[model samples]
Structures are given as structure tokens and as C-alpha cells.
Target: MPGFLKAYVRWVDSANRAIGYAAMLLIFVMVGILIYSSIMKTVDIPPLWTLEMAQFALMAYFLLGGPYAMQMGAHVRMDLLYSTWSDRRKAQVDCFTIVFLLIYLGFLLYGGLSSTMYALEYDERSFSAWRPYMAPIKIIMTFGVFLMLLQTLSELIKDVAKLRGESLS
Candidate 1:
């Protein structure tokens, strides 16, 4: 194994693992706060914005941590097709898959940006008891899409290098 490839993989894995921890903490906090609010509501002292924030936080958790999941091989995949391929074919498939994901993410980014802009221009707010900022949640879509795109590029590069007999780890 080449030293540089090992170092690069280690760096990416370590950075992503740290990010995963932070995301998990956020998810835990959001859940805890919602439960506490629900309990408080029984005493007629509900946290008015807890539900709203929880909804946004849940979305944030999913999108923000999506790439981390992919990096860790935690995403669902139909490996029946992939398992049949030689390593070179598998790498090619991976490259193409990354391309598809990049295109999909590009659309998501555009749509998310448009939606966010529209919401912001209209001063949109959630139509609920909390009336939280809707645009911010929409803006999260952009961030999430970009993260996915970046991670896909990294994986594609790694696979292509592997196909050339270059060790990434």
C-alpha cells in the first residue's frame, strides 16, 4: 500500500467520522428537546417552537449527514447488480453512478435555491403555531446537496484511481 493513499483515506475517514458525531449529537438534542416540550405541555407550559424546530432539525439531520453515511458505506444499494461485476467494471459503474448523483444534486441545488429565493422574497413563514423561517430550512437543501456532490466526487476519484491499480487505502 502506498503511504500517500493510506494517509488520504485516513484523513477523509477521520474528518467524516468527527462530522458524524456532531450530527448525531444534534439529532439527539432535537429529540430530547421535543420530548421535554411534550412533557411540559401536560402542565400547560409547552415549548411553542419545539415542534417546528424539531421538524427542521430532522431535515437538517438527514441531509447534513447524508454524505457522511455514504462515506461510511451506510447507504442502501442494490448490490445484486454490482456484485456480479469485475473490479474494473464495478469501478466504472461507480464512476457512472457518481456522475448521476452529481447531476441529480445539481438539479436539487437549483431547485432548492429557487425555492429558497421565492420564500425569502415573500417573507415566507411556516403556517403553524410557531411560524418559523421557512427559507432557512429550504436553504438547508442547498447545503445538503453540495455535501453529497462533494462526497460523490471524492468516491469517484478514489474508485478511478483504484481501477488504475492505485491503492486509496
Candidate 2:
């Protein structure tokens, strides 16, 4: 592989790792919020925004964690059939499926970004009492889709490289 391509892969890997770790941490934070909210409820205190906050955090976690999961080969797959395939065959199958992946990601990126723009233009906010702004979450979701697209490209490159007997692992 070219030095630049290798470096680009490394950069993507680092970014996905950072995003995934942060999302994992946010899951814990969300759990903590839920626990706190439960305690507050038991104590007769209003945890008015805890549910909203947790839902938002959960959305961020799932979106941001996507690329990382793909990078780590942790995403769901048909392992039973895949395990029987040879390396070259596996790479070919992955490459074939990647087209659909790219298509899906492209649509998701477009929709997320458009929604974010609409939210910003309209000054959209949650309907709940706390009424937090929605644009940030939409933006984050768009960013996540962008990152996933990058990761998909990296994977495609690696697959092609493998087929060429040049491992870019």
C-alpha cells in the first residue's frame, strides 16, 4: 500500500476508536442518569429532563459507535456462511455488499444533514418541557454517517488490497 493510504487508514482508525470510546463512556453516563432519576423519583423529587437527556445520549451513542463497530469487525454478519468461505471469496462478497452499504450511508447522511438544516432554520426544539434544541443531535448523526462512509471506504480499499495479495490490515 502507498504510505499515504496507510496513513489515511490509521487516521480513520484513530478517529473511529475515539468516537467509539466516547460513545461507550456516554452509555455509562446515561445509565447513571437513569439511576439518579429513579432515586429522585423515589425521593419525591422531579427528574423532569432525565428521560429526555438519556434518550438523546443514547442516540448519540448508537450513531457515533457505528464506524467503530464496523472498523472492529463487530457489526452483525452472516457468520455461519461467511466462516465457510475462503479469504478471497470473503473479500469478494464483502466488496459486493459494500455497494449497498455505501448507498445506504449516502442516503442516511443526506437525510440527517437535511433534517439538521431544517431544525436550525426553524429553530426546532424538543416538545418536552426541557425543550432542548434538536439541531445538535441531528448534526452529530450526520457526522456519524460521514465517519461511517469514510470507514466503509477504508474497508473497501483494504478488501481490494487483500485481493491483490497486499494486506493492509
Candidate 3:
């Protein structure tokens, strides 16, 4: 592999690792918020934003950690037959599935970005009583999908390299 491509993949891997850790931290914070809210509720002092904040944290957690999941090969798929395939065959199958993943993620990223921009321009907010701005979550979604796209490109390169009998690692 060229030094540049190696650097790019390493950068992507690092970014995903950082994001994954952030997601883990978010989960802990969310749990704390819920626990505090529960304890406070017993004293009849429930926090109004706890649920809303939890929802936001959960959304960010799932979206931002997606690239890490992909890197770890944790996504669900039909693996019963795939597990028996050879490396080249696996690469071929991955190439086919990656095309579809890229297409779908492209559309998702576009839509999320558009919605986020619109929300920012119009000062959109949730309908809930707390009414937090929606743009931040949408922006995060768009960025998360963009990260996935980058990781997908890295995976594609690896698959193609494997198919061609080139050692990328």
C-alpha cells in the first residue's frame, strides 16, 4: 500500500476509535442522568429534560459509534454461509454488499445534511416541552454517516486489494 492510503486508513481508524470512546462516555452520562432522574422522582422532583436528553444521547450514541461497529465487523448479516467462504470469495461478497451500503448511506447523508441545514436556517426545535434545537442532532447524523462513508471506502480498498492479491496491511 502507498504511504498515503495507509495514512488515510489509519486516520479513519483513529477517528472511529475516538468517536467510539465518546459514545461510550455518552452512554455512561445517559445512565447517570436516568438514575438521577429516577432518584429525584422518588422525592417528587423529576427533571423535565432527563427523558429528552436521554433520547438525544441515545441517538448520538448509535449514530456516532456506527463506524466503530463496522470496523469491528459487528453489524448483523447472513453469516451462516458467509463463514465458510474463502478470503477471496469473502472479498467478492463484501464488494457487492459495500456497493449497496455506499448507495444507501449516500442518500441518508444527503437527506440528513439537507434537513440539518434547513433546521439551522429556520431555527427548528423539537415539539416537546423542553424544545431543544433539532439541527445539532441532524448535523451529528450527517457527520456520522459521512464517517461511515469514509470507513466504507477504506473497506472497499481492502477488499479490492485482497481480490488483487495485494497486501494492504
Candidate 4:
């Protein structure tokens, strides 16, 4: 691979790793939120935002961590036939199938951006009693999707390199 492509791969991997690690902390935050909610409920002082906030944290955790999961090859796959394939064969198959992934991510990004824009423009809020503005989470979700797209492209590059009997690392 060329110098620029190598740099791009390195940069994306580093950024996603940092984001993923930060996202991992959200699980603890979610747990704390739920625990607080439980304690408040026991005292007959349940907060209206606890449940919804916890849900939002969960969403952020997964979405933000997705790119790192893909980068680490932690995403699920069917192993019935794939586990038996040779490395070159796997690379070939990945190179071909990655087109579908790219297409799907493209559509997802488009829709996410549109929804995020609407939220920002209209100051959209959830229908829950807490009624928090939706733009912040929408923006985070869209950014996560964008990172996933970049990571997917990096994977495609790596697959192509593997097919050529080269190493990006």
C-alpha cells in the first residue's frame, strides 16, 4: 500500500480505539444511573429521567464502540463455511462482501445525517416526561456511524493488501 493509505489506516484505528475505550466506561455510568433510579424508587422519589438516560447511555455505548469492534474483528460472522476457508480465500470473500457493507453503511449515514439535521433545526425532544432534546444523541449516533464507515473502508484496504500477499501493519 501507499504511504497515505497506511497513514489513514493507522489514524482511523487509533481514533476508534480511543473512542471505543471511552465508550466502554458508559456501561458503568448506565449501571450507576439504574442503581440510583432503584434507590430513588425505594424512597418514593424516582426521577423521571433515569430510565431514559440509561437507555441513551446504552445506545451511545454500542454505537460509539462499533467501529473498534469491527476493527478488532469482533463483529459476528457465520462460521459454518467461513471458518474452513484459507486466508487468501477469506480475503477474496471479504473484498467482495465488503461492497454490500459499504452500501448499507452509506444509506445508514445518509438517513442519520438527515434525522440529525431535523433534530437540530426543530429542537426535537423525546416524548418522555423528561423531554430532553434529541440533537445531542443524534449527533453522537451520526458521528459513530461515520466512524464505522471509515473503519469499514480501512478493513477493505487491509483485505486487499492481504489478497496481494502484503501487510498494512
Highest lDDT against the true fold, candidate: 4
Question: TM-score, each model?
Answer: 0.81, 0.94, 0.94, 0.98
Q: Write the per-residue lDDT of candidate 4 for residues 88-147, one digit (tens) a residue.
A: 999999999999999999999999999999999999999999999999999999999999
* Superposed Cα RMSD, model 4: 0.7
- Which pairs of residues collide in model 4? none
Q: Clash pairs of candidate 3?
A: none
Cα lDDT tens digits for candidate 1, 1-169: 4566566656666665666667777789788879988899999998788887887788888888887998988999888887788989988888877887888888988888888899899999988987887888888767777777767766776887878897675
The alpha-carbon lDDT assigned to residue 157 of candidate 1 equals 69
For model 2, residues 1-169, the per-residue Cα lDDT tens digits are 8888888888998899998998889899899999999999998997789999899889889889989999999998989999899999999999999999999999988898889999999999999999999998888888989999999988988888889899776
Report the candidate with higher TM-score, 3 versus 4: 4
Better of 1 and 4 by TM-score: 4
Candidate 1, which segments miss by more than 4 Å at Cα? 1-18, 84-86
Report the alpha-carbon TM-score of model 3 versus the true structure: 0.94
Against the hidden true structure, what lDDT does model 4 obtain?
A: 0.96
Worst 10 residues of 2 by lDDT: 160-169
**Clash count (model 2, backbone only):** 0
Worst 10 residues of 1 by lDDT: 1-10
Give lDDT tens digits, candidate 3, residues 1-169: 6788878888898899798878878888889889989999999998888999988888889889989888888988788999899999999999998999999999998888889889999999999888889988888888889999998988888888899898776
